[model samples]
Target: MPTITEAYVDSLAPNAGAIKNGRDLIKKNSFPVLNESPDATLLFGECNGSGKEPYRCSVDFVNEASPVFRCSCPSRQFPCKHALGLLYARAMGSPFTPAEVPQDIADKRDKAEKREEKKKDAAESEGNAPAAKRKVNKSALVKKFASQLEGLRLLEKLVLQLVQSGLGSVDKKTVQMIEEQAKQLGNHFIPGVQAKLRAFVHTMQTEGDREAIYSQAMEQLLLMHSLVKKGVSYLEKRMENPELPMETGTSLEEQLGHAWQLAELREYGRAQSGAELLQLSFLSYADAARGEYVDAGWWVDLSDGTVRSTRHLRPFRAARALKEEDTVRAVVRTEELFVYPGEVNARVRWETATQREAGEADYSKVKAAAAASYADVVKQVKNIIKNPLADKTPVMLVAFRSIDKTADGLCLRDAQGKLLPVTDLKTNGSATSALIALLDEKDLRDQAALVMFSHRLDDNRLSVQLMSIVTDSRFIRLLY
Candidate 1:
């Protein structure tokens, strides 16, 4: 028998708003628990909802770390507010007298256990299968390497052209050329690279200011240069030693935008520990011509402090339908995460989750994990100057004292009077306005505010893209 903690339960919430709503239910005593029991590996409770009868809610903690939640509430949110309140009560350490397990709950738990056992049996059988079926096809492998080599050549050529012509010459025609090259790379089975190129083109097309766009373009170009160089070297090594043992997917493929299968990644993640859901965000990229919308989710490993991300893309019109719950932060179990293949900080997907007790949001802890000084961040960025992918490097500035409005744009200053210029303010006008309003309302010139941002190096100057602003009483996410 294992106990559920507040933090583990909170990890099940879809977003901060859900947790708040669930808390309201508890505070209002809206769903009074009628019958409560904690058995060997299960917790059951019946709570009065809006309906005539109480809503039956139960959490199966047989898995201990990753519990299963079920509730009769009609709410569309998984686990529903009723379920959250029920678990919240238990997480608060409310005493539950020992009682006989209800027949219904017993049956459900038995069925779940049987299903898990069957899954284990199937996995064991698969593992015991003949090794001949797992043999690699040398010819296919060679063909893939050759295709990647060709892609590397195309990428190298593209990089050279971008550098020679300069970011100022990047126009619709230039974008078209890059798009065509990206399509060719996709044909070569290197979709990771294709995606990176498409993202770069999208940024260049959407950004309005000529100088700012150039800076971003140069950053993208540098990333492409590094990726191509690394990819070529990796492929050459594989060609030389075809029998080399690679545990995970190659870093070159990931840098080139190769995505791992969700099922496989999930299986791999479940075998390890320390996975926790961290944040969720609704991302949008659009111009007059086209639009893209994505739901991005982040997970962090509590043990090793590794970060992974998952993304769900929707149609352009779907952007308007997104709600705050779609982008909330929570902690989840590692088994619920499916990690993408990468050297470090790989992307991940949410496989399975259940509602349980939740804990308070700790912004300080998150900031600490990602915090770095302006100089340190700049030095790190310089170290990876050859592979300057914007998303890969995130910096969190803790307790900056003031926001200085520069002639060009805004800048943030620390208590020690160090300054960091803010760049990539594109597509975050609302957040920017909100921060400015907070600063004005609070007279925060000398007050502390936390800033989460990323760096962009261009023309020997380091600039930051403000991602989020966190104060003592407020948290505003600026990045989409």
Candidate 2:
């Protein structure tokens, strides 16, 4: 059995809010009773919640791979804060008094085992029945493609008009017209493009430095143009085939506003087996135009050097039902990890995951995976973002001999003394780089850092954002 780690407990949380609430309990010392079974497979705690009576929470890990979370709380959230707090406390090396397994939990486990046995027998009785195949709606795809093409033409025309007329000529009426055209994209089932258009409109709407706004507007137009050009060809080809295989290298469907299913990804040979992932950083933001709150976490594949992301989209309309994602500090081991189509840091999802503590070997692997040279990684990143449709911001781990603040910016020196400038607050619209100043001298030397390559169109410079700094002794994350 593996030891529970901080990352594993974070993974069990429904959302960031739950993790915060759970952490608050530990900080306040609200749990008076923290006990574990003799073998430590079962953990029980009493956490004070809103109600006067404390909530009794039990996490039964009789099955190490898939533990059962049971809590006496009114929250619709599974494995509510109380249960998560208990797991967090355990991971933090909290001392739990040895105790016998509760008889009720033991009985429940017995019933569960019997149910599982029945399920296994029933499944075996089926005797190699083939799985059902889902039908494809070709007509729907065709109509969508046609409508999207029309929408693209309209979008291009709008941009051309705006550009030709110049920003100075744009008035309220013009903005209204642009808004109407952008809204039509929703009808074409390309809400992703629609969101980009809305962002462009927002840039125009905001009262800011005129020159800056113009530059931003141009950048938005360029980004959208990239999508439209490639998207046109992609949709046309898909329309002709109606069953074209999904692209694994680029996010064509995302731009076309298609939500991919796990089955589709697996069928397209995009699923990786026996994957081990560890989170490097987490991010959360509100998508105003889409009325959705998006939370994304970046995780490095311990098996390989590739970094993947897990995104949770909670729409305002479904906020109550959907949970917002948070940080996971544990190593995620899964049988099948579905990879979504995109550029660097492709979105990933898994139906089930088992997490355990990362050992020294694991940490060493991460350090070993870091690119020893800065120039090589930057060259690769530049090549990827050359295309307008390419994902500009991609996380890369780079080994640094030392970090020094120079006249330019926070620069990381390689063995060759080749410096890569980073730690720009405006690089990725984040102030996380400021955290580096708080670090002592020892932590800044002979380590590697995870950086996101961000292209600042305003400066016409490709900036690097330091997401976290990892050393043999510590992994300090600067991003949330």
Candidate 3:
């Protein structure tokens, strides 16, 4: 590592905040400069953070690696402070190399200029040198296409059957049928076709005239059928000869899936557990008409994808809760992993668990399981609430006031404070054993703090809440 002098650090004054943040991170944890490119003047760094995934930040060194981009934290300011600090660190004498600017960034800048030039050359035409491109096996694709077509045809038949049964409209049952059919098709191969169909259905709901909507769907289906028929023969012949254009759908899935999967792969469930999530909360102070941004959540890095773990915070220090939104952006390694399921109308369940080790093992007697330590339980609980595994399964009772009144059922409350009575937090059919186990864990016996639970009942409905964990303490243990 080269020694970065105080003089070189002065050059990053424009990005002082970033420099400070990055340096602070280094003081507590090591974030080596990961990569740098001389031509693009870009530098990248990977940070050490608590989560299932690591954090990465990049600075445009040519632009003075002044903390232009950060992927872990929630703040949106460009050149995040972390990036700045890293560049400053590197400038001082880090052993980093400059490489060719990555194509994506370069292409991005190139397209911007190209669009501008189009105004001067309206008739402009250009082509790169022709190269032999790998051909897709049309036969295999046709077979896959035929299978999906059959599934859709079955779905269409099912829809017709519903109509025959005097179904006036596409109701809940019809949608379920459609979803099931879509899921089956999705399992067959094409990944995003189901989502596309769902989107079409949503669009149909917006426009009046159910018949017209059905007609439109029929047309789209026909077009799909026709496209398949036209390409099948050529695809089959090409497959035998091994020469054809690459299939479009596969790339689309790869591009979209890669981003989503990459984010999923990096998520570390244990990081959000314990006191951190319980105590973690945020506030937004905004001066409208100026620029306004709030700290949403943390970011976690998994093996393949990057996830931005965020929480919607009620105005804690501010006058009121400001505007909040969630977005997934693979363009700059930022993502919002859906922790709790049933987010739109239903409650989602998110939980993290950390196991505690029992100190001594009993050799003579059948070895008794060691009780989990309170600290370990608390940690696990935090992560669970922070980044839950599924957004579909709702847990029972998010928070409970006291364990004494077991009959005093926990009520689900909306943001408007409407009380939604629930039969059980764990729901019917499925035993509430898991919920009870988490609640009865001896680790929580000592602290009378707010307890958060994912209340589930028989149906798909779920309720979440933050209850008073302690009768004495002033603090509200955020149940995430």
Q: TM-score for each prediction? A: 0.63, 0.87, 0.26
1 or 2, greater by lDDT:
2
The weakest ten consecutive residues by lDDT in model 3 span 362-371
- Model 3 gets an lDDT of 0.39
Per-residue lDDT tens digits for candidate 2, residues 237-304, read 98899877766667878876778988788777899888999888888887776788888888889988
> What is the Cα-based lDDT of residue 292 in candidate 2?
89
Worst 10 residues of 2 by lDDT: 423-432
The best candidate in terms of TM-score = 2
What does candidate 1 score on TM?
Answer: 0.63
Q: Deviation in angstroms for 467 in model 2? A: 1.4
Q: What RMSD, rounded to one decimal, does every model reach?
A: 6.8, 3.3, 22.0
User: 332-381, model 1: which lDDT tens digit per residue?
Assistant: 55554555555434666654554322243444444345433556645665
Which has the greatest lDDT?
2
Residue 357 alpha-carbon offset, candidate 1, angstroms: 7.9
37-155 per-residue lDDT for model 3 (tens digits) = 76545666666666656566665433321223545656565445566556655655556656566666567557756875895565344234353344566677667656545554554
* Model 1 segments more than 4 A misplaced: 1-105, 117-134, 154-181, 200-222, 245-251, 261-272, 275-292, 297-374, 389-393, 397-417, 422-424, 427-430, 433-460, 465-480
State the displacement of the C-alpha of residue 366, model 3, in Å, after optimal TM-score superposition. 80
Candidate 2 vs candidate 3, lDDT winner = 2
Winner of 1 and 3 under TM-score: 1
